[model samples]
Target: MTNPYAASGVDTEAGDRAVELMKQAVSSTHNNLVLGSFGGFAGMIDASILKSYDHPILATSTDGVGTKVAIAQAMDKHDTIGQDLVGMVVDDIVVTGARSLFMTDYIACGLLEPTRIADIVRGIAKACKAVDVALVGGETAEHPGLLKPHEYDVAGAAVGVVEKDKILSSEKVQVGDVVLGLQSSGLHSNGYSLVRKIVADNNWQYTDLIAEFGRTLGEELLEPTALYTGVLNKLLQDIRYQNKFSTMSHITGGGIAANLSRVLPAHVSLDVQRSTWQPQPVFQVLAESAGINLFDLESTWNLGLGFAIVVREDSAASIIGSLRELGVSSWQLGVIEPKPENAESKGYLSSAKGTHGGSVRLVGEYAK
Candidate 1:
């Protein structure tokens, strides 16, 4: 028997095998809330949990691994990429003071390798379990003609829930509010296009070892993004910390100043000090190797801080101490202050991602 679909480059049998291999990992993320089983036309999650909230708000976000997928693909490592996807999508939901309830992922690839697909899904399932989110459903589409074989990209969307009154909108930011910089686990999956450009320009090999990173270039670049949802959820649940944090920025594509600005109130501004903490050596290595301006690097990648939280000045120490106990290094960037009539700065990001809210200015010198 001749299979037209296989001839057309879509392997149905491989897809079935991939699904079969992914079964255990997927089922592991499932809870009693998940309805039906895998392979259903659509996924259903029990929404009864929302009834507990007087005014529940549904929060959803969609995001991908970005060009960092190239690093995973380059290294032939698929496991950690799923964690990165979870970090990107669910973490954004966390910024709204929501607890992720469910998630779905989409993978488009030129070829359907059963083991590879299973590995990616396993990572996704593992990460979902870590944050108590269910991997309700997902799709793996093979686009052989549109994409080169061995190439694939993964994206996912997460749904979370928060009580209306419990949402942290950053409107509470005041002159005495403290800005805390949450340390990142390396680059954490943004600005990879520039990273690729740097590698290509310098003729660097993925196998090449940079003394500063203490690992092969590819390995250093592939570090999975640090998951913050569990930590945030814990903070929100604690009596001492509930509503203590008014604003949080998931420092992604816009770098520090821009993402931080998205949460600032119009009446105040934040001065993110560079000396708060030393940047990871990866940034210094890339900056010196690329010979690019530090500002250019700062505007693209996180440099060091992965997440920013604005809290009442009195709560700053406790929050930092909590983060430390949670195994995340933390420091203060600056304090919130009233926006002056004549606000100007040599280094500032007024707005980003079409957000024209409060502004942020970079100040102080690097610790080197």
Candidate 2:
């Protein structure tokens, strides 16, 4: 009465039950644009929507949650990690000023615990619904021999559409652009390898009560990443802001300067003023514990800002004001200018990500 596949390792029944438990949450994210029902081998979305565009360009991004998953596993928490996944994947699509259409996730785990798998997908569905992106389909792969039962990883791909002319990039950057920063919700989903190292070296428990955070260390670290798609897309939809912005930077693994460099032209140089903002308490604590200087932190953590928008200087006030109204704490982080003559001597990084781009440097000191 035993199937050979089940006998070997894969649990077909558990996978099915995980799908069943996650069906409602997943279906909740789908709109009429999502064609076909769940359980389809390949997900379908109505591409006819693109006909309305003059020149619709598709933007696709794939990303994983990274070592932050270790914290989730350590705390036995899975729900909030999905938002991190959505933020890592869909936000990249939105960086191109694209409207996210749909997303698919893949989970690789040694054993498929139906409830745990359902929790992860439910989180993904919740985040997708927030951004109005359909959760069309997903897969859960069981790797019994390669991974332990409790060990797993999550990644996803997002699809979005933007008019060709509206695509934001470094090519649109002009002199005197105002660089605005969007606040992040804790560490988001990057640099957790170092975060874990700090925690382990200090022998800190995930449940350790830290006064600065006012919550357990694990809760603070596991705080869901902020979703920029909904807010950024909302800003893009407003006619008043048309053609006022050039490019955006999503501060992830590369930190502020490196990621911002990804969207800059070769001739531009930007010095992100650290005096404009202070590192969050969590960052401060980690830095103090690790005895590393602010520069090292800058290369790893987001510090405070999670996303940045480079806009025309004239629109700086209005854009930051709009972000405030949208409940996003934003500030003028810096300005774009002609490349400084002393950029190389000043240690500006133009090719941090290995692309031919503008130079960026973190200058001054973070406000105390």
Candidate 3:
């Protein structure tokens, strides 16, 4: 019997094989909390554990790998993109002071290449295991006419839990709190559209080795997003730093200012010192190649800091010490201040919004 779907480039057998190849990796992330495996109709996690909480609030987030998938396709590298996907979605939940419980991913591809798909799932499983999050289930759709055969896009949704009193929000942020900046691994999965455009403009090939990066441009850019949940989970579990922490921001699209501003309380403004950390080589290279100013660069890419936290000024030293103990490099970027009269400044900081949503700004030299 002729198979209609196979002829149309939707290979059911390939999909099945991909699932088979991915089973062990997926199963490795499962525990008693994960009720069943990925083959089920839906992913299941035993929330019975939540009964221990006086008031449990579930935090959920969904995000895609963005145009960075184009780079993955260009390099034929599928593994690390999964980590990028997990970082984008799961870390957002982490910002809410929630521990990730489970995650499901979706991949849309022009064709189902079993090995490639397996590689992607393996990355996701590894990251899930690292963060103790269950890889409950996922979907991979083969779109023949809709997407190019060589191209695929990845996205994921993560669910997490925190006690109602433990949730991190702007309400807890106050004037004089210190903003701590966590170093990024690289571009960390955002600003790839600008990255791609810069590469295209400069005629840079994915395989071309750049001296500054000390590796192929594609390899440097494809570096997996740093997994902060483990370190953060450590911080959250410790008693000393718990209540002292106010809120966190995962620097993503619209850069540090935009993402940080989303979590600021009405009266507090985030003051960022540009010289606090060194900019990675990739940012400098992109800025030079694209002729982008520091302001646009900071607004587009992470500019070095990928994750940030607002903590009571007194707790800043302890938090940085703890981050150091976890082997994560961090520094105090600036202090929260009462919203100023003009509320707008140039340099590393975003224009301050007096009260209401708040604003971030950068001041000082860009440490090369």
Q: Estimate every model's Cα lDDT from 0 to 1.
A: 0.88, 0.92, 0.88
Index of the highest-lDDT prediction:
2
Q: Candidate 1 vs candidate 2: which has greater TM-score?
A: 2
lDDT of 1 at 324: 91
Which digits, one per residue and each the tens of the lDDT, describe model 2 over residues 179-290?
Answer: 9999898788889999999999999999999999999999999999999999999989899899998999899998888899889998999999999998889999998999
Q: Which stretches of candidate 3 lie over 4 Å from their true place?
A: 345-356
Query: In model 3, which range of ten residues has the least summed lDDT?
Result: 346-355
Q: Per TM-score, what order, best first?
A: 2, 1, 3
User: Which runs of model 2 end up more than 4 angstroms from their true locations?
Assistant: none
Least accurate stretch of 10 residues (summed lDDT) in model 1?
341-350
Clash count of each predicted structure:
0, 0, 6
Q: Quote each prediction's TM-score.
A: 0.97, 0.98, 0.96
**TM-score for candidate 3:** 0.96
User: What are the clashing pairs of model 2?
Assistant: none
Q: Write the per-residue lDDT of candidate 3 for residues 176-279, one digit (tens) a residue.
A: 89999999999999889889999999999999999999999999989999989878988998999869989998998878787888788656676788878888
